[model samples]
Target: MFFILDMFILAGIFGFLYGFLLQKADFCFTASLRDWISVRDSRIGKGVLVLIATAMIGWGIVLTLGLATVGEVWSMPIGFSNLIGGVLFGIGMTIAGSCASGALYRAGMGYIQFWIVIASMMIGNLLFALVYDPWASDYVMEPLQLAEGGFTLFQLNLPFLLIPLVIVALMLFIAFRQFGWSGVWQGAKDSLQDFKGNPFTKSHWDIRFVAVLLGIIATIQFVVMSSISITGPETRIAGVLLSFVFGDDFVYQNTYLNGMFADFPTIGLGPEETLVIFMIVGAFVSAILSKSFRIRKPKLARMPYAVGGGLLMGISSRMAPGCNIANVIPGIGGLSISSLIVVIGMAVGVFIATAYIFKMPLLLFQKMDFDDSGS
Candidate 1:
């Protein structure tokens, strides 16, 4: 019992940290993607890339020493599941205006619309129950599954060090050509300097600080919870409700359902659920502390998109057998082929949704985060 309590407490701490930092950084996968897609803003994307690189380094070190809870790389299976789900997820994020993590944290910031968005996500998860046996099994997922063990980085013993090394080299190469050694030295100095006042209580941290810290948190989460995703549990709330209505045995008909909730919580206290729940709580507290909490009424016109997008998010997250963060942070970090497919599918989905449905710009090659004149 105490051990369980300890795990929950740890998860709560991690969730709080994530929520606080995410809110401060205004980091959302959807926002990052949309900014790049609609207007070519790469500020958030660059931070996310840094976060992925950091997680790769951190998890790689932990895995190398066999310190992670799971003994091996927790690579997802290579299948159409990731591809199909990723596309759907990307569309959902665009529609809903936030990914699962972003919505949770934003909901914490007192967005009334996202609270509904959160509930809609649950509905989306249960909706999958209806499709799992009928069409998804033989037609959509199984026959389309291309590989059993995902094309994993572990298969080739790929070193995690390569990510940081390459990133450094790339940055230096750009900096040298642009600003020379003086600029590179200035960048290094700026990065290494300590934050003023209490770093923990402040908002608007550097993208690098936020990215590296988030990576550390992700590594800790993997080691502590042994779960690949927060989205899995977020959506599993629907599963728990599904089991409640259909009974566990009936719901267990789907193998994916069975595996996802193998240790289904009895008192709503599983490590996975606890983490997400506290994440919301943590974000709320962060918002309150930062005086950023304000109830923004959701526009009625946007509600349908939130509902539809959320449902799609729920379904696709499971379909991809991953989430936005999974595909980016750990997914890329682990170098899983399935993750790569999902990433591509998501980009495609975003392209379709943003360009066609919403009539957003499709300026793919435009220089992001540049001045209006592209200077």
Candidate 2:
């Protein structure tokens, strides 16, 4: 009992840190991709890359110290699952105005729209779990054993230091050309000054600060939790809800759902669920403390889009076997081939959603339609 309590406490601490930093930085994956596509603003995207690079470095150290192994890289067939799932997720995020992590944190900030998204996402998960196998066999190819012959950057035997160094060098080059040394220095100084103020009431941390903190938090999450993801908790919630509605054996009886549970067993509120709950609590507290908490009721017309978006997000996340936070951030950090495939598919999906569905300008320098009042 004491051990369980301690685990919950630790999960809550990590979740709270994740929520607080995410809110302060406004680090929504959807927003990062949209900004880069629409306005050529890559700051948030670069921050994401920084986070991945930092995680890679941290993982390298962990491996060097024999604290962990690289065995966590997901082994799945390289096929249409990634592309289709990623595309769906991208479309869902665009319509919902946030990804899974973004929705969770924003919902904590009292966004009614995100609540709808969450509910719809649960329904999507339940539905997809019911039909995963046929979809997998029809679309996904034969399973590739990553440890045996499957591809991964880590399999290439490259120096562990090379990946992070390359990413950092690219970021520096972009920053130097875009902001210059003086501008960058001034921005850093301003960020420092902002940090010196009362974080609870006066100001929030800068994006760079949030990025570094997220990297460190993710690293710690790996060391402590043995897994890092925001979607796992939602999956547990869906499973529990299904069991309540259908019967206790609902998840265990179903083939796909059973397989899912095999990987992430739902035996009461697990650490992931606890982490998610605390994430919401932490975000709410942060919002209240920052005087930013307010009920953001969506326009009635937008509710349908939110629901549809969320449903798509849920389905795609499950099909891909992970959401952006689960598949993209940690996946990239671990140099998984599946992550690379999913990223490509997501980029394509984002392009289609932004350009065709949302009718946003695809080309850089093109004017963006800021008015989202109409569908």
Candidate 3:
């Protein structure tokens, strides 16, 4: 019970931090793609790189300390699923106007259209669940082998964690050297402040802080892993919850339950699943308090685009075995060749989504018919 309490506490803290940072940084990968493709903003990309670097460093430390194993990390197989699913998922994101993670995080900010998006997503997931049996039997790739055992840069005979950290840090420092710390000016401060004045300069210190927060989140993951030894489906926890609505046989096959539901049976929700729920709740509560909650109505005509995009997201995630956070962060940490493929898939998905699909002439023109706001 005390452990559960501790886990909740830890989850609350992490959730709060994630919400706070996300709100402040506007760290939506989908939006990042949109901004970069539509305009030209490297800040979002920089933020993502920082997160990857932080997770890598934290994961390396965990590996060295033997606190976590990379076995599960590399478990995802790469085959035709990689190319086909990835491309499809990319196409879905372009249509939906957000990625899976993007939907989760932004929904907390009170985006109303995401409400419909998620409903569609849930429907899409249910569709996946129905088809999973056949798909599992037929699709999926073989295990990928990395050159070395685990996630160390040493395996590749590269520099230590600090070396890459320093190099990246230096590059960012040079890039933002001239910015001011004000809200409206490039040289303004990066701290949470009103953007009423000059554009705030994002400080090196703040970047370091966010990076450290990300590292801390990784560390807490170790604690989470230790506290609850169960490693059932996490990304699909919502799917699991929805299974109840659909009479999931795996969850309630008998009076006592069975399958994945019974395989790792426990008294209550798993730590990570509970944590994810709290994260969403925490973000929502924070948004309400901060008065940042805003509803975005999808353009009526583009609704089909959103639906099509969402469907793609569902199918692709089912094929790829995970989404961005699921595959990339832990994937790189565990040094899975499949994850590297997923990263390639992610980049490919982003490019295909950004350039070919979302930015296409016909789609944009159609979208403009609904949202003449010139979004």
Candidate 4:
């Protein structure tokens, strides 16, 4: 009972932090892609690097201490499916104007378009479930296991965890040193500043801070995985509740149901689904407090973008074994090679879609003009 209560509390706190920071930072892959493709904004690019660097460092620490077993985290099969799935997910993000978590957070902010996007996502997931057989037969590489004993940085037989720690520390020092004291101070000031004037101010440094926090938050995944095995079911449960409230009677059956509620050592709800639901709730509560909630219909032409993008995410999440928030970070931190592939695929997908397909304009300039029009 106490452990269960602690899970709920930890989840709540985690969700709250994500909701608060995500809203404040406007940290959407969609926006980052837009900036990269259209306006050449490299802040988000820098942020991605920070996330990887910090995650690798943190993972090294956990490995040395034996605090958690990296062997348990989800990994991709690493082949054509990962590449294809990544491309599809990228396209969807461009069109929908957000990724899966981004959609939820925006929905919390009362964005009207994401209703359709989320609906499309669920539909896509259902379609994937139905067609999973062919996918299983054709594309999957043999599931990776730690027993195979492949070479890794740690596998090279380095002494003490401090070696990687020292390296990471040095790299971080160099990163800040390159920017100098003024840049460091400016970055610190900007992260704490109000969100009115310039959104990109000190964003490069802020990404590092966000990455560190995300790494800490990510440690919870170790606990979540050790305790649960019912990810898709939890997601389905939340979707069912929402669908029913909205008057939909879709009944999609999953084979994992009976096993989920059992208190057997290998059974329970997956963290991905639980985290997704609570994060949405946290975003909702945060938006209300920040008074940033507003409802507006998306442009008609953008509808296809939302629907198509969501469908792609559904397919990719299934193919890659998890979504960005779930599989990628934890997979990487846990030293799963498959997560690296998924991240690569996701990045490439974003690049191709943003550079070629969606081509959303650098709208920051236009947002100022839109404000000018109202004034």
Q: Model 2 over residues 175-239: C-alpha lDDT tens digits?
A: 78989999878866765565665776643667776777788888778877755676656877878
Ranking of all predicted structures according to lDDT, beginning with the best and ending with the worst? 1, 2, 4, 3
Please write out the lDDT profile of model 3 over residues 1-375, one tens digit for every residue.
Answer: 224567667765665556555554555656555555555556676666666666666666665566665443343654656656666666677678776656655777777666566556655654665565544433432232222233424245544355446645775666566442332244224422444443223211243345456556755665454321111234246456655675565445333123334434542355555655555565576566656667766678877876777666766676665665555456654455555666567667777777766554334445566687655
Cα shift from native, residue 349, model 2 (Å):
1.6
Alpha-carbon local distance difference test for all models: 0.75, 0.74, 0.55, 0.59
RMSD of each: 3.7, 4.9, 7.6, 7.8
TM-scores for all candidates?
0.87, 0.88, 0.71, 0.74
Off by over 4 Å in 4: 1-5, 134-156, 159-182, 193-208, 220-235, 238-272, 360-375
Error of 3 at 92 (Å): 1.8
Candidate 4 residue pairs in backbone clash = 92-309, 95-305
RMSD of 3: 7.6
Residue 286: error of model 2 in Å?
Answer: 0.7
Best by lDDT: 1
Q: What TM-score does candidate 3 reach? A: 0.71
Would you give me the overall lDDT of model 2?
0.74
Error of 1 at 6 (Å): 1.8
Give model 4's TM-score versus the native structure: 0.74
